[model samples]
Target: MTSMTMLEAINATLRDEMARDDRVLLLGQDVAQLGGVFRATEGLLERFGPDRVVDMPLAEAVIVGAAIGLAAAGLVPVAEMQFLGFSHQAFHQIGAQLARMRYRSQGRFPMPVVLRAPFGGGVRTPELHSEALEAQFVQSPGLQVVMPATAADAKGLLQTAIRQPDPVLFCEPLRGYRLVRDEVPDGDAPVPFGTARVAREGDDVTIIAWSAAVHVARRAADRLAEENISAAVLDLRTLVPLDEAGILDAVAATGRAVVVHEAPFTGGFGAEVVATISDGAFYSLEAPVARVCPPDTPYPAGKIEDYYLPSVERVVAAARATVKAP
Candidate 1:
C-alpha cells in the first residue's frame, strides 16, 4: 500500500494507461505544458511527450469536438474541461454528437473518450470553476457520470473510464485533490462502474453521497456516533449506472435514508436517488427520504460559499430529522 493524494493517484493512472496503450492521448488547455491549473496532469507531458499529451486552446467545445473525431478514428482521447462549469461550452458536442455516434452509426463508430472536469466548491475557487452540475449529465442519456471520493477510487475509476468504449464524464472533487490522502493498493486496480462502497457500517440511517459530499457524510456520521446515532455511509462512486441494489439494500437495512451532494437541492442528483429509493424501497422505509444539499442558487462567491455548501452539521441535522420525524 502507498499513501497518495487524489491528484497523485490520477496522475499515476494516466501515466500507467499511456504507457500501456499508445492510442491513449490527452488534450486540454494547459494540460501538456502547464500540467493543468490544478497540476493533476503534472509530469505527464514529460513522460508521454508532446504528441500524446497535446495542449489545446481555451475552447471546451473545440476540445471535446476534436476528441470525438479522435475517438471515432480509434484513438482513446481524455479531454479535460478545466472546471465543471466550463463543460457547458461542449454540451452540444458531448450530448448530441459523441453520445449518439455509436447508435447513429449502428455500432460502426465507438467513442472511447473520457471527459474529465474538476467540480465542487470547498476550495474557494473563482466563479464558474467549482459548480457541481451533475444533474445536467445525468439527464442526458448514453453518457456515464462517475464521481470518486477517495484517492484509491480516483485512480481505479479513471482507468476504467479511459478503457470504456462509451463516453464517460469523470467528475473529480476539487476539494479531495490535495486535502485527502489514503493508502492506495499497489499495482493496477480499476474499480468497476455501478458499484457502491460502504464507507461506514451502521444500523440507524443510511447516508448516500458521492464525490466531495462523501467525506462530509463520513464526518457527519462520525460526529453522530457520539450522540448514539450510527449512520451507514454509502459512497455511490458511479452516478449514471447507479448501484440501485446496493442503495436499496442499505436503506432497507437502516430503515431511513438521506441523500447528499454539493449540487443545488432543486433538481439535484440527490433527488434522483430519493426517487429511486421511494420506488424500490418504499415498503421498507421507516421515515421519509431526506436530502442534504446546497440551496437552489448559483454557486456563491468565495465569501458566502461556506453558507451555500452543505456542512457536517447540516448533514447531521438531516440524519437526525430522519430518525426523529413522526
Candidate 2:
C-alpha cells in the first residue's frame, strides 16, 4: 500500500501507463513544457519524450478532434482540457465524432481515447474552471463519465479509462487533487466501471454521490450517526455506466435515499439516482427520494462558491428529512 494525494496518484498513474504501453501518449495545452496546469503530467515529458507528450495550441475542439484521429490510427491518446468548463468548446468533436466513431463505423473503429478534466468548486478558480458538468457529458450514448473521490480510486479508475476501448470522460475534482489522500494498491489492476463503493454501512438512508460530493455525503453520514440516524454512503464512481444494481441494493437495504452532487438540482445526475431507485427499488422505499445539490443555476464565481457547492450541512439536513419522512 502507498499513501499519496489524489493529484500524486494521477501523476503516478499516467507515468505508469505511459511506461507500460508504448502507444499511450498525452497531448494538451501546456502538457509538455509546463507539465500541465496542475502538474499532473510533471516529469512525464522528460520520461516519455516530446513525440508522446506533445503540447498543442489552446483549442479544445482541435485537441479532441486530434485525439479521435490518433485513436483511429492505433495509438491511445489522452486529451486534457485545461478546465472541464472549457470542454464546452469541444462538444462537436466529443459528442458527434469521438463518441460515435465505433457505431458510425459499425465496430470498425475503436475510440480508445481518454479525456481528462478537473472540475468542482473551491480553490477560488476563475469562471469556467470549476463547473461540475458530468451530468451534461454523460448524455452522449457511447461516452463513459468517471469521477474519482479518493486517491486510490483516482489511480485505479484512470487506469481503467486509459485501457478501455471506448471513450471516457475522466472528471477529477479540483478540490480533491491535493486535498484527498489514501492507501492505493500496488498493482496495475484497473477498477471496473458500473460499480459503486460502499463508503459506510447503515440501515436508515443511503446517501448517493460522486466525485467531491462523495466526501460531502460521507461527512454527512458521520454526523447523522452521532444522532442515531443510521445513513449509508454510496459513492457512485462512474455516472455513464451507472451502478443500477448497487443503487437498488443500497436503497433496498436502507429503504430511503438522498442523492447528492455538485451540479444543480433540476437535471443533475442526482435526479437519475432518484429515478433509478424509484424505478428499481420502489417497493422498498419508505419515504420519497430526496436530492441534495446546489440550486438550478450556472456555477457561481469564486467569492460565493461555498454557497454554491453542496455542503455537508445541506447533505445532513436532507438525510435527516428523508429519515424523518412518514
Candidate 3:
C-alpha cells in the first residue's frame, strides 16, 4: 500500500510499464524535455532515454497518425494529447484509421495504442484544455474510453490501457490529479476494463458518475445520508466498455438513479446511462432517471466555470428529487 496523489500514481505507472516492457514508448509535445504539461512523464525521459521518450511536434494529427504506424509495426506507443479538447485535431486518425485498423486488416494488425489526455473543469486551464468530450470517443467503435477518479484506479487503469490490444482513450480528471489520493496496490496486475466500482452502498437512490464527478456523487451521498435518504454512489470507471451488469445491479438495488458528469446534458454520457437503465432495469425503477449536468453550451471560461460544472449541491438535489419522485 502506498499513499500517493493521482499524478504520482500515473507517473509511477508509466515508469513501471516502460521498465517492464521494452517495446513500450511515449511520444507527445513537451513530454520528454518538459516532462509533460502535467508532469505525468517527469522522469521517464531520463530513465528511458530519448529513443523511447521521443518528443513530438505540436500536431495532434501527425502524432496520432504516427502512433498508428508505430503500433502496426509492433511497438506499443502511448501518445499524449495534452488536453482532450485538442484530440479533435486527430479525430480522423483516431476515429477512422487507428480505430478500424484491426477490422480493416481482418485481425492481422493489432492497434495497441494508448492515447492519454487530462480533461474536466475545475483546473482553471485555458480554452480547449478542460473540455469533457468523452461522449464523442465513446461513439467510436473500436476505441475504449476510460476515466479514473482516484489515485489507485488511475494506476490500475493505465496499466490495463497500456497492455490492451485495442486502442484506448485514457481520460484523466484534471481536478483529481492533485486533489484525490489513495493507497494503490503494489503489483503489476492490471485492473480489467468494463468494471464499475461501488463508492458507497445504499437503497434509496443510485448516483452514477465517472471521472471527477464521482467525487461529487460521493459527497452528495454523504449529505443525503444526513437526511436519512440512503443513496448509493456508482463509479463507472470506463465508459466505452461500460459495465452493464454493475450499472443494472446498482440501479436495481436502489430503484432510483441520478446520472452525473462534468459534460453537457444533451448528448452527454449520462444520457447513455439513463437509456441503459431504461432498457435493462426499467421494471425495477421506481422513478424516472435524473441527470445532473451542465447545459449544452461551450465550456465557459474559468471565471464562471463553477456555474458550468456539476457540483455536489446539484447532485444532492437530483438524488433527492429522484428519491422523492412518485
Candidate 4:
C-alpha cells in the first residue's frame, strides 16, 4: 500500500488506467500543456503524447460532446470539467446525449464515459467554482453519480467509473484533493458501486454522508463520542446507485440517523436519504431523521464559508438533538 493524497491517487490512477488500456484517453482545458488546473493530469502528456492526453478549448459543451462521440465510436473517454460549476454549460450534452446514449441505442453503445469535476467548499474558490450541486446531477436519469471522500475511495471509485459500461459523473471534493490522505492498495481492482462503507462503527446513531461531508461526519462522530454518544459514519460513496439496504441496516441498528451534506438543505441529496430511511426504517427510528446542510442561499464567499457550509459543530448538534429527542 502507498500513502497518498486524493489528488496523487487520482493522478496515479489515471496514469495506470491509460497504460493498462490504450483506448482510455483524457481531454480537458489545459490538460496537456498546463497539466490541468489542479495538476491531476500532470506529466501525462509527455508519457502518453498529445493524441491520448489532449488539450481542448475552453468549452465544457465541446469537451463533453467530443467525449460522447468518442464513446459512441469505441474509445473510453474520461472528460474533466475543471470545476463542477462549469458543468452547467454542458448540461444538455451530458443529460441528453451522453447519458441516454446506451438506452437510446438499444444495446449498441455502452456509453462508457466518465465526466469528472472538482467541487465542494473550502480552499476559497471564486464564483462558479465551489458549488456542490450533486443533487442536480442525481435528478438526471441515466447517470451514475459518484463522490469519493477519501484518497483510497477516490482511487478505487475512479477506477470503477472508468471501467464500467455506464456513464458516470464523478464528483471530487476540491478541499479533499490535497487535504485527505490514505493508504491506497496497489491493485487496480474496481470498487463495486452502490456499496457504502462504514467509516466508524457506533450503535447510538447513523451519520450518512459522501465526498467532503464524510470527513465532517467523522469529526462530529468523534466529538459525540466524547459525550458517550456513539455515532456510526456511513459513507455512501455513490449516490445514483445508492445502497438502500446498507442505509436501512445502519439506521435499524442505531435507531437514529443524521444525514450530512454540503448542498442546500431544501433539496440536497440528504433529502433522498432521509426519505429512504423514512420508507424503509421508519419504525426503527427513535427520533426524526435530522439533516445538517447549507442554507437555501447560493454558495457563500470564502470569508463566510466556515459559517455557511455544514461544520462539525452543526453535525454534532444535530446528532445530539436526535439522540436526546423524546
Instruction: Output the lDDT of residue 116, model 2.
Output: 96
lDDT tens digits by residue: candidate 3, 1-326? 89999999999999999999999999999999989988999999999999999899899999999999999899999999989999999999999998889999999988999999999999788899899999998888999999999999999999999988999999999989989999998878588899999999998999999999999999999999999999999999999899999999999998999999999989999999989999999999999999989998999999999999988999889889889989
Candidate 4 whole-model C-alpha lDDT, 0 to 1? 0.94
Positional deviation of residue 79's Cα in model 1 after best superposition, in angstroms = 0.9
Q: Return the lDDT, model 2, position 140.
A: 92
Q: Give the Å error, residue 26, model 1.
A: 0.4
Tens digit per residue, CA lDDT, model 1, 214-277: 9999999999999999999999999989999999999999999999999998889898999899
Which scores higher on lDDT, 1 or 3? Answer: 3
**C-alpha lDDT of residue 185 in model 1:** 78
- Which scores higher on lDDT, 2 or 3? 3
TM per candidate comes to 0.99, 0.99, 0.99, 0.99
Report the Cα lDDT for residue 82, model 1: 91
State the lDDT of candidate 2 residue by residue for 209-276, as single tens digits. 99988899989999999999999999999998999999999999989999988988888888888888
RMSD of 4: 0.7
Off by over 4 Å in 1: none
Q: Per-prediction RMSD in angstroms?
A: 0.8, 0.7, 0.7, 0.7
TM-score of 1: 0.99
